[model samples]
Target: MDTHITGRTAADIADSVRSLLERGVLEPGDALPPVRTLADRLGVNRNTAVAAYRQLTQAGIAVSRGRAGTRIVDRAPVPQEGFAAGSVLRDVGTGNPDAALIPDPSRALADVVGRPVLYGEPVIDRELEQWALEWLGADLAPRDIRVTVTSGAVDAVERLLAQALTRDDAVALENPCFLSAIHTVRLGGYRAVPVPVDEQGMTPAGLRAALDDGVRAVVCTPRAQNPTGASLTAERAAELRAVLADHPYVLVIEDDHFSMLSHAPAQSLIGAHHRRWALVRSVSKFLGPDMCLAVTATDPYTADRLAMRLSPGTTWVSHLLQRLAFSLITDPEVREGITRAGAHYAERNDSFAARLRAYGLPCTPGDGLNVWLALPAPARAVAEQLMRRGWLPRTGEEFAVDGLPGSAHLRLTVHELDDTDAERLAADIAEAVRAVSRSGSGMIDR
Candidate 1:
């Protein structure tokens, strides 16, 4: 009998598997012995082997496939938001704001210089905090809230989850979720319970299902959701809030990342009476990614816990950055420029969507910096064809939580593309879809 996975206790066996993984003895996708077989071999209860596999799954080291048994998960780095480094193709997949649209900080920076902020002082800049309070208070009105500053939306979410959840906790995320959110949940060892999103935003049925599954935290993008650009309608938001009202203790995080840039009106899923909720607005979208700052408004209890993690003399955001962000955002000229920028993004995306529709492809002018184009063929195959035609696009599969096959959508960032480039890219996508359909390599979902 092979004694490779020899251990009597669940933790012991899980540790042994990790050791084997570290030594490259058990490669990714390699199936482990059946629980019963392993238990018999190790002279332990079958439940012990099951528990071992559960531990590995929770740690993201392995995956359980029921009757097919468990296997080591491939830990390759997931794709993130940015330009593809060194790619020669006309990259339309990059989910970036227009450089021309970002407000100029040169004048703001010159005036932002102030006294050096010493340790043990307040982490948040007083001016920035006052501005953020009015800003966040406008939307999250009637509910008493406390504000906390973080490096960015992603940073705020990580800290929020860390304060509220532990390992193996379940977090409800949108099905075609934000890339950063997916990565954060996985890296934190939280099981992501996917909630399906429709044109109006997160479905009430999906939210209910996730809550029923015992998710401890729910992360939602109320407006301009990433990848799909699905904004929550007021009716949908009301429905979701009603669903969430029962679970008042569950931590709800609304990442309104596209606060200034979104063409859609703001809608929220956090109920007025909910006890634990947060609204995170980041300036990275309109102010440029270099400005790493996000203002978060949360219930007082969550705020207290988050403050401890972001205490003075530790991980507090830099006062200089806060001052600079404040100056730029509050400047009347900069605010006017930001409004124009938002309009620019909306117009470009709308034009591209119209171009795709002209080519017989279905696409909606969703709110965001990118257009979620639906194709008649598999997104991966079409993406490959587009690459050959001098274009780079992000397949919807890259954004899917479950990595389901036959994804027929591509997220294209065409706002920066000129009229000629936009038309050419749209024509190329139509051609690629036709070619892939003719090849019949995979079944098309749509």
Candidate 2:
């Protein structure tokens, strides 16, 4: 079948490609014609064909591989954190907090429903704003800051990037980045400049290289960085800030997703003198994912821009939800529960890491819901062996940025596992590694 893409103008050409995709004539991985070939065939200028390809790329309907040519994006759904649907295997890869650890919102719901919020009223609930101000101000003091309520950390990041960046603008992202962050960047049609992350968080040199490459914005995870669970140390934070001291205008967004649930103290990359920045703290980790409320603290200018997108009467966050979150977070009993939850995650993750280490795997219990287990063989090979043993784990390659080499690690969420299961998993992981080694299939660099 001759898959036809027929049009003269750029918009028309792009629309034709979309039509072909819709009709199943142009499948994913199918390459569009070279600009010159398409132009000659359609009797249009070469630039017109280029522009059409660019439009498709920006819409995420296609991807450009330079000399290799542009091809359709798969459009398959990206894997998200949480349970895998209908899986019979024991899932140790679900990046979810223990449901029992989340604070009960039943008691707080009654106190939060005092009054109905109407249009033209302040978007943020007054009580929530006050509480959020104090909470964020403690970390980002002396600098003028304003609070904006977003649906969640992902929403805040998307909005923040939209407000500060235009399509095709470059943004710095961690090498083994969070899934949502990667999706957000790609969907926004922005270029993601990879910054390598080490044990102490994003390396200063990597940040410098990204800044040198002209990234307009940088998204950082201050604590409990997803996937690897790496947190920035005080010294490393200072070094990163120093590197950014020169380029103070680049918008810096810190997504502190595991805020109340993180055992590590927050180490900020946003310096006092920085011109534009945002610190986003979501309540989902401690209050439950369904809460869907995140408090973003940012410079006045950034706050103003974000507010425009979240303007009252149209896109504002629900005042009732904000009030409920504030009520639960400030309650004494809820506070204790959050603290205990943090401890429980830390203890369980540590115990699992110790067991993996005893089995000869170089696993570390980072300050998050998962353990990053370094494998001597390929992570996929080990994961395959694990699956054969009725276990499912997330491979580190899934979190790695595009253009980077495949990873030799696995991110396992073992915090919910009891001692018996934990031990079994450890033993299974050891057996998996040994099986891979004996097969002599996937030996690669660490």
Q: Estimate each model's TM-score.
A: 0.92, 0.94
Off by over 4 Å in 2: 1-3, 57-60, 312-314, 403-405
Candidate 2's TM-score:
0.94
lDDT of 2 by residue, 1-446 (tens): 12388887999999999999999999987888888888888899999999999999878788887898888876656667888899999999989989999877888888888767786788888888998899998987478889999899999999999999877789999988898999898778788998999899999999999999999999999898888889999999999999999998999999999988888888899998999999999988888889998999999999999988776434788888888888888889999999999999999999998898888887777898888888888888999999999999999888876734457889999888999999999999999989989999968756
In angstroms, give how far residue 77 of model 1 lies from its true place: 2.4
Q: Please give, for residues 288-309, the per-residue lDDT of candidate 1 as tens digits.
A: 9999999999999999999987
lDDT of 1: 0.89
TM-score of 1: 0.92
Instruction: Candidate 1: count the clashes.
Output: 0
